[model samples]
Each structure stands twice: as structure tokens, then as C-alpha cells.
Target: MNVIPYNYSPEAIRLGILHIGVGNFHRAHQQFYINRLLEDSDQQHWGVCGVCLLPSDKNVVENLRSQNLEYTLTVCGRHGGDEVYQIGSLRELIWGVEQPEMVIQKIAEDTIKIITLTITEGGYNINKETNEFDFEDEKIKHDLHYKDQPITVFGFLAAGLRKRRAGNCSGITILSCDNLQHNGDTAKKAFISFIQAQDKDLAEWAEAHVTFPNSMVDRITPATTAENIAKLNELSGANDKAPVHCEDFCQWVIEDHFIGGRPALERVGVAFTADVTTYENMKLSLLNASHTLLSYPAFLKGYRKVDEAMRDDDICRYIRDFMDIDISPYVPPPAGIDLEKYKQTLLERFANRSISDQVSRLCADGISKFPVYIVPNLAKMIKDRKDLTRLAFLIAAYRHYLKYQLDEQGQAYDILEPAKSVEDEQLIESDSAADFLNLSAFKSLNLKTAETFVPVYLNFVNAIKDKGISETLKLLTA
Candidate 1:
């Protein structure tokens, strides 16, 4: 394997971007672009400062700091070739758990112009139904009281901005690289709302200074398992403890609304556009929604890996139908993209055996995912009175995956839904399928009152429980 070493020296680079939630996706996506930029001697000032906040990030924090903030990123090509690169752009690692003040201080520095985030959908702490910041969150309330010493993402950001305001520092753009529609606008809403609740003056300042550029990010990055790390190390001929891997396919389309100076990301494949909504809609509706459509049923059918699930004839056919028939008619093709080719590419990306993306990862956050990905098109389909069997089947499978962790083969699997609220938990536990309609994930639509959709959903729910996932999938797809 040929490992592409970054030509720039990490020590000589300056920290210009502070990225929160330094996970596999971030390592492969934004960091990958910045790694390329660092090769240009002029762009060395744009080195990344990775921030790890959650307790689960402790291992990554320790591993990265020990490795001098350098790691190998194996870009696994879908066509049986792989390219490895030594990523050295993350010059610094700060865990807010220990160095809370330091995290804030770094953000306050005018040198850090862009604060990129991969905090996941739930990480924003938005009330999905209302499309509002969750003010009642315990962390938000606590952070509001102790503003100086912050813990939550919002707390740290607000506190950092406040201190930055005091110093009359230059404006900074909070770029959200998450998979949410209108991510920058969403970030602005959540962060600004949180700031307004705490300090009106800072909120006013942020309104004028801080810019949130919406972006659409794409890449099939899986959770790096122990086996992945070991294999990557062997293939790269180096003992890299914090190795990350992803498919060769990568894209980022950003809204050109940076108040402060922005990186020359356009020089790389990163698309800087006036509006990212078209790209955002195309991705969320087709790629993300299709993932949700396939995940639960695949998981219930005893499939752990996404590539393996894609191999199943019925599963692949169902996903293609969902994308082409169910949602494609509603989604407008983005300016330069060929919708048919894009759909085919998405199918190919999902079936890439080299990456081996996990079904469990796709099944992780149904609570936050459904409202954004499936709800809009679902509502449209309901109004138009289209065939509701596919989406209805997905909801039934989702409920089963949440309520009972057992698969069709009688093997049990762990469910990861970090976004489930108290109400969601209660509804999931209810014996009646009707109660699931009240879930926050389905709050956008009155699933119970959708006369055409409800009965079909109920029938599928009954069918899934009685006949198991595989049989129900066959009948539904047939």
C-alpha cells in the first residue's frame, strides 16, 4: 500500500480551525481536506485544533495526544484499491473534560476563525418536533447558571464567544459539518437561541459578527473497530493507534457566507456555493433517508454490516425502489448532478465491501433521523396518496428494533439511540403499536390520523411481530 505522507510540518503550522467532535467522519472528511491544504506552504496556518468533549472521547484524546496528533487515514477505494495518508493537521488536542478553560481560551483567540463541528444530529440538542433549541435540557440549565466554567457544547461555545466578544476579537464562522438539512442555519438557530437565553448582549453581538455557513458533507465512514485498526496498521506498515478509514467518495458543498476569512477549500473538491439547500435536500432525502429505510429491516434480518445487507436481493431492490420511486420524483436534481447517476452511485457506495459500513451505525439515532430524512417526503406522499407500504414498513421495523433487541435469527443486538427522550422511551415500551405514533420522531405528521398510512402501518407492525423481519420484507417488497 502506498501511504501519502503530508508534505507540511505539523510544528510549523498554526491552528486556524477548532473542530469539535473529533470522530472517524471528521478525520476522514474535513481533516482530509485540510491535510491537502496544508501541503500548500501558504495554507500551513490553517492547521486544525481537535476538541474532544464527551467521556467516550477519552480514548481518542489519549491516543491522538500520544501519537503527536498524527494518524493514518486509509481511503478505501470501492474498486479494490486503497490509499493511505498520514494526517498531521491536528496540531493540538484539547479535551474540555480536563482543560475546560483552555478550550474556551482557544476559541476566544482571533486566530481560530472557523469552528467546524461533527457533533451528530442529537449533539445540537434541538427539540425535533418544534424545530427549537431544547431549553429544558438539564445540561443547558446547569450551564446557564455556571457560565464561566462550562461543560456542554453550547456552554463552551457561548462562553467562548462571550470572552471573544470582550476582547473585540475578529468574527468566527461556526460551520456545522453534520448531516442535517440547512446545517449552518440550524447551528445558528441552536447556538443563537442558547446565547439569547443566557445573555441578550452577546446574542446581539453574535447576530452581527458570527456567520453559520450551511454545508452538505458526504462519505461512507464507519465506526473504527479494533479489527479495522489492526488491519489498517498491517496494511500501512505502521503501528498507528488512531487509524481512520472511509470510502474514496467524499463531498462538501458549503454556503459562501463566511464573515471571517475562509480557507481555500474550493481549490480542493469542496464546493463553495451561494446556497447549499439543493445539495442538502438531494443528500438528506436520497442518501440519508434511504439509510434509515434499509437499516432497521436489515438489522432485524440479522445483518450487521451494510455491505452484506446490500448484497441481499430484496433489500437492495427495496432501497433502490424507495430512492427512485418514492422520493426521486419529489426531489429536484441539484444544478450539476445527474439524479439517475447519483442514485446509482449511492447504491454502489452502499455496497462497497471494502468499507464494510455497519448497519448498527445507520440504525443508531432513529429518533433524530426520521424527522429530517423521512418525514417531509412521507408527508408529501400521504397528501398525494402514493403507495405508503415502504415507509410504513420502515416505521414498524424501527419500533421493533427499539422495543425488542432480538433479531430474526434469535440473536440479540445492542441498539444505539442516544437521542431518545423520556417520552420516546415510554412510547417504545408500550404494548400497543398505536402509541408509537406519538413519538417525537413522528411529531411532524399525525401518523395516527393519516387514514391511508395508519392502517397500512398498523398492518405492517402486526406482520413484523407475527412473521419476523425477513418474511415481512419479502411480502412488502413483493
Candidate 2:
């Protein structure tokens, strides 16, 4: 039960990467890669400086700092074994709320070549309907007015890049590790827009010197609960507080477009390519969209974990059919990727018991997820005149889950969503599927008017209303 030792001295590591949003996924995926890279070579300069923006992240910063910015990463394999490694890739942890000036200074440092982000899907603040930066957002407005004391990630990035420009530090790459489509491009747009509103000169400087490389990052790092921490401590025989546990499977496809030199990430299983769109599309459509498709139905049926839902034959079949019949047609096989095997692999990943990914995690932020994961394929299916009954059922399930915040066992849960308009709530309450489809959430595709979509969606909605989610799923799979 001894923990794996670190290769390099923690004091010797240099911070070349400044990572925003020091969440579980960032620790497990990106930092894990840096740890691997550091172990193999003299890449001590590529160490990460973790940055936590929100006040809620204060505890994480304190935990990492108390541990000398070192923690155990327990990687669980599907074959029923765990590998524990003490990750020292994080050289320092910065709490942005406590020291905003230090966060800016860190970004402006010449040694910091790349800045990565794992801010959740909503962190971009793109209007779901417009797919553009929501300048009218109160946070954006506040960040613009009070640039010196910023709160959001956008403000931090803008202020940091401005400092870098003033210092004449070399250009740097902003790598987005979020799951959104064209994530790098999205970050570019959002950051540039934020800067433009604050200072036209900084925006121009960012446009010239800053590079946002889109990346497709994959890993199932669940939120670390106290139970997980206890188990990790027991397994690793260490009293680490912020240990991260994730499935052993990991993949990072990044665009090789860094302005400043990047780590030898390719040496440690990172895929650097000219284009990451195909890979991004494949993962988002098959894996992410399937997560969304299964989550609401599974949760409504009282299944709390993804693997538990995957064990149900009806739910499994529905997801398989949804992928093969509806989504696969839209997702072209990426180079060197076999679509069928990839789809099967996705099923296995979802079924990985070691990860124990929560259904609620997948269910959170559906409003943001749908546009990136579900909508584009859905739009294509409608355009191709294909049967969307299964997809329609997914939408129906999502609506039902939202309207009734109670699961099948009568346990009530809060729906974590942005403020819903009265009209949106009325639509959810309305029995008409068409009314629900007309929601601005679905306005991107005008899904309500898709001739074949409306009737099937309405039928499923009515059936779910009459029968429960479990019964409806059984009928659909049968």
C-alpha cells in the first residue's frame, strides 16, 4: 500500500503552465500528464501553477498549499485495480479571490508558457441560443466596470494578458480543456470579447499575441467526496486531503499551436495535431451526447450512478441504439479510429465501476450541454429525415426530469440550472411537446418545426406522462 514516489524534487520544479480552475478534472487529467512528463525527462520547467478563481475554491487552494502542493492521484482501472501516484506536478496553488494581483502576475510571467483551463461548460458564458459571448450578463458587466477587482475567469484572463502585454512578455497559448466543440476557438472569442469591452488596446494585443488552441480532453474524474478521500487515504496509506480519483482511461488531443514552447506532452501519450475537430466531434457526439441521453432517463428511474444505469438492459439498449442509429451517422470516424469499437469502448467507459460517476454530475448544466453535445447531431438527423424517436425520448426525459424534480423513488433534488424565465417554466409545465421544443434552448435548430421530430417527441412525452420513465423506456427498447 505504499504510494508511488515522485521523480523530481518538489522544490526544483519550475512553473511553466498556469492552469485556471483547479478542479478535479484538471488535477486528474492535465496535471497527471505533466507528472508523467516530469517523471521521464528533465522537464522540471513544465510544472503547473494551479489557480482557483471562485471563492468556493478557497478550500481546495488551502488543501493543496498545506500539502506542499502535492497530492496522491488514485487511478482506477476497469479490471479492478488502482494505481496510486503522488503528483508533484503542481508547483504552486494560487487562490485568485485572495490575491487577484498575484494571479495576474503569474500569467504575465515569461516562464509561464501556457495557460490551461478546465472551467466547466458554463464558464464560457456563451448565450446558449446565440452561441456568442453574453455581454449583457451581469458578471461580464461587472468585470468590465471593475477590471482591477475581477471575479470571473474572463476578467482574470483579460487582466492577466494585459499585464503580459505591458511587461512585453512573449506570447502564450491558452489551452481550453473543456468539452465544448471548438473549445479553443470558443475561448478565443469569449476572451477577446471580454477584453474588447474593457479595453480595445488589450483586446488587440490579445488578438495578436494570445493563442487559444482547441483541445479535446477525456476522463471521468468524479467530484471527490469525503468517502472517496477516506478510501484514497486508506489505499495510499497517506493523509492527503485533496487526492483525486479517476478512471485509468485518458486521452488529450490538442492543437499544436502554442506561441510559447509547450511541454513534451506528446512524449507522454498526448496527441498533438493540426486539426482536432474530428476527434472533438467524435467524442462529443458519441460519448458526451450519450451521457446526456442516459442521465435524465436514468435519474428519473432512480438510478444514481452511471454504471448502475448502464447495468440495466433496457437503458443499455436505448443508449446503444441511440448511438448507432442516430448519432454515428453524423460522426465520421476520426483518423485511425474505428467507429464501432469506439462506440463499444464508450459503453465500457460508462460502465467502469471504479469511477462510479454520478448521474447528477452528468445531469448538471444540461442547458449548456445540449447545445454542444445533442443539438448539432439532432439538427443533422432532422435534416437527413431520419427517425429521431430515441433522441426525442431523451428530450422528453430531460423535460420530465426538470418539471418534476423528484426521482422515481420520490426523492426530491434541486435542478441546477440558470434562472429560468416564467415562459420557460410555463413551457415545461405545458403538456405540449411542441411548446417545450420552442424554448430558446432549442431555438438554434428550430426543433419544434422539424416535421418528423414533433410527433415522435410529443408521443414519448405523453407516454412518459401516462407511464413512468422506467415503463416508457421498457416499451421503447422493446
Candidate 3:
């Protein structure tokens, strides 16, 4: 009945921060930074109380509970790798259904100074039409009226904020560590919209008291696999709840805008900057964009692992050309970053075969992923009348990719559309690919001017049908 792991301490209940979506990325990147802070200050004040947003998250919740919420991080690098078993940063793990009230109570607690979210990009529930809170969503409506039944991340955050505000918990910070552009601003906008729709007085109170810090987080902790578990047991001699294995590379750039207390994470390679927009855009456009490039077409070609995709000369070259030709020009490097060096490092990280990040996982939610990661670079290229040949092919590849086609290997696949709607589906299937480009989400791209996109897309579909992914990649490069 000893659920606790060897050498793992009992869960430390601290009133510092609430982290939603305690996935591998959060544990490896964010919690690792917190662990560094703990090392220096000996302060358990910043310890995290982890929360899962969905009921399906019981797998992670039960795993954590079984291990007494203990885990290890295997930091893999080119030269060598090491394990940090049970680093002891996280304090408590609470599932949404089991303890929704408990989550709100913690957020309401005066000692809980900050909240961090890594709830993935899709978790935000952003409306494509307005790029704001999807107020019309049935769940949002339910949460607005009934405080007891929480469904959306924004709903839980709003409820918690409402409670926090009622308790005069001002000076609290909300940090968003998702792969979103100006993520903190988006979080703030979501909260503000919710409050205004429900109660203007509360909106003003949040605006006056709350601070949302924009942040850029980079570390590839792919979904844990059985192989990963076996490796962790072999290497670390510890069985983790959700053991995180990542490339040695990790970076967190945050805007210095916390209202409550924040850790001095800068001591551990986290950059606190005046403007994090450039850093965010650089990562999203370069790394995330390159990821999509490999994820879609490569996955279609029967590549499951990230390194497998990267190993394909054709796929790796396409990804490289995407960064070199399209993304880099638009990426204005933030202070203290070298763009060339960063790009080289990203490629190396992508080529790391040990992690085995799934292309299907990356390919999921492309409807949301591309607009932020790839489309922006293409838009900039279109405006300047630049060589969108590669960019066009990327879009074309995506169009062909969405049809849920299988490879010669008989592997099943499906693309995650922004919304499961006929109109949304038409974004990829339309005869006029340009018209589809006018989808509410991508209208900002001003695709009407890009005369070459439709024809290029049409040709791309033809190439895939006639020539296949490998051959089409060659043609695009040529």
C-alpha cells in the first residue's frame, strides 16, 4: 500500500501557484525551472498545485496518485543524458471532476499568488470569428450561469478569479506557457471578455489587479510511450507517473509583468524581458512551423516519429528550406538571441531520434496550429511578392493531408479541423483554394492578393495523387 516512490518526499502542500494541464512539457520545462528556484531560495512558497481541466485526465491523475504524485525527468542530449528522479517541485495533483471546488478554493486562497497555464493551444476555446472567448459555446454559457459545473479552462479560470477577487486577492499573476503568440495577452482578453459579458464591475477589478505575463516555452516532451517508461526504469531506477523525456534544449522567455510574486527563474536560464512578442513569434514561426511541415505530409507518408520524419532527406530538406526561405526573414530575434544559432539548434533538436515524438500528435489540431505557426510567414511572403513557392507547397501538402488519406502501408489518419463543420472542411476541399483561405481564421492573411496560391495548391493535390509525398517534396525543392 506504499504508493510513494523510493526517496520521494510526501506531497508538499504550498500556496504559491496553480498550474493547469500538468503535462510533460509543464513538468520538464516549467517545473524544472521552479525546481531550480527551490534549490536557491529553499522556498517551497512557489510550489505548484497541478490541476487537470478535463474528466478524461483521470489517467494522469490516477498515475500521479499511485506514485504519490512523484515523477522523473530524463534530460537527453547529444553528448550524454541524465535523470532527475523525483525533483520534488509539484505539490498536489487534483482532477477537475473529483475536486472542482478544491481547485477554486486553492485559487481563492490568499497565499496562491500566481497561476500558470499549459492547457495547450486548443484548450483556450478561442472563437475563430472573433479570436476572443467563444461566449456562445454551450459550456461557456453553462459556466457563466452555473458556478458548480465547470467545463472550459476559461470557465474554471474565471470562476477561480471571481473567487479570488471576492477574497480581495489582488496582485495575482496569470502566466500562459502555451505555444501561442502573446499568450498572456490572449489569456487576459479571455478573462476580460468573460467578466464584461457577465459583470463589468468584476472586469474592472481583474484589470486593476491581475497581470497576465506573456511567455515563450520551448521543449519537446512528446507523449510518454511504453518504450519511454522502460527506458526511464532502466536509466533512472524510478517509475514516474508521467515520466518526461526531452532534448537537452529548453528555453522560457517571459515578460516581466507579474503582479503577485514570481520565482527568480532568470537564474536558471529563463529570460525575463520587456517584450516577449519577438521571442514568441520567432519560436512559433521557426520551430513550430517547421514541426507542422514535417508532421502533416511526413505523417501521411507513414512517418510516425519526429526523428523518422527528420531523417527523410526530402522531409528534412523541406523543413530546412521552410525556415531558411520563409520563417527566418519574418522572425525578428528578441534581445540576447542569435537567430542563426537558434535555427541551427532547433534543427538539431528536431533530428533527435531518441525522443520519438509522434507526427500524428503534432499533426492534430493543424487548423489552429497552421494559422499561428505557418500562415503568418506565408502572409508576409505574399505581401512582399516573395517566393512563396515553398510556402505554397506547404499549404498544398496540408490540403492533401486533411483528406484523411492512408499511405500504401494501410495506416489510418485524420486531420483535426478547427471545427467539425462543413464550411471548415471546405477550407481544404474548395475548388478555389484562395476562397477557402478566406476562412474567418485566415482572413487576416489577406490571401485575396495571393493569386498563385490556388493554382499552386491545385498542382500540389495533383502532385500528391500522381507523384506522391516524396516526389512532390522534390518538386517543391526544385
Question: Which has the greatest lDDT?
Answer: 1
Question: What C-alpha lDDT, on a 0 to 100 scale, does residue 456 get in candidate 1?
Answer: 90
Please give each candidate's TM-score.
Answer: 0.98, 0.97, 0.93
Give the winner by TM-score.
1
Give a tens-digit lDDT track for model 2, residues 1-478.
7788878777777889999989999999998899988875568899898899888888888888898888999998887878999888988888988989999889889999999998888788887777788998788899999987888888888888888888889999999999999999999988888898899999888888989888999998998889989988999999998999999899999999998888888998999999999999999999999999999999999998899999999999999999888887788887899999999988998999988999999999787788889998888888889888898999999998988788778899998776455687888888666788866568799887788888898888888888889999999999
Report model 2's TM-score to 2 decimal places: 0.97
Residue-wise C-alpha lDDT for candidate 3, range 1-478, written one tens digit per residue: 1222223233443548889888878988888777666655445577788999777788888987787676777777745555454557777888878888888888788888888998777667777656768877788898888765677776677778788888876678989999999898888888778768866777888888899989999998887888778877677766565777787888999999888778778877999889888889888988898887778778777888888777788887787777887777788897778998988888788878666688878888877776678766776777787877676676666666765467635677665555545676676567665555666556667665668566676677678778887778877766
lDDT of 1 at 145: 90
lDDT of 1 by residue, 1-478 (tens): 7688999777789989999999999999999999998888888889999998988899999998888989999998889989999998899999999899999999999999999999998788888778889888888999989999788999999999999999999999999999999999889999999999999999999999999999999998999999999999999998888999999999999999988898898888899889898899999999999999989999999999999999999999899899988999898988878999999999999999999999989998888889889998999999999999899999999999999989999998887777887888999999999899989889879898889988998999999999999999998778
lDDT of all the models against the reference? Answer: 0.92, 0.88, 0.76
Ranking by lDDT: 1, 2, 3
Cα error of candidate 3 at position 144, Å? 1.5
State, as a TM-score between 0 and 1, how close model 3 is to the true structure: 0.93
Candidate 3 lDDT (Cα, whole model)? 0.76
Can you tell me which runs of candidate 3 are displaced by over 4 Å? 1-13, 408-410, 416-418, 426-441, 446-449
Better of 1 and 2 by TM-score: 1
Of the pair 2 and 3, which is ahead by lDDT?
Answer: 2
Give stretches of model 1 more than 4 Å off: none
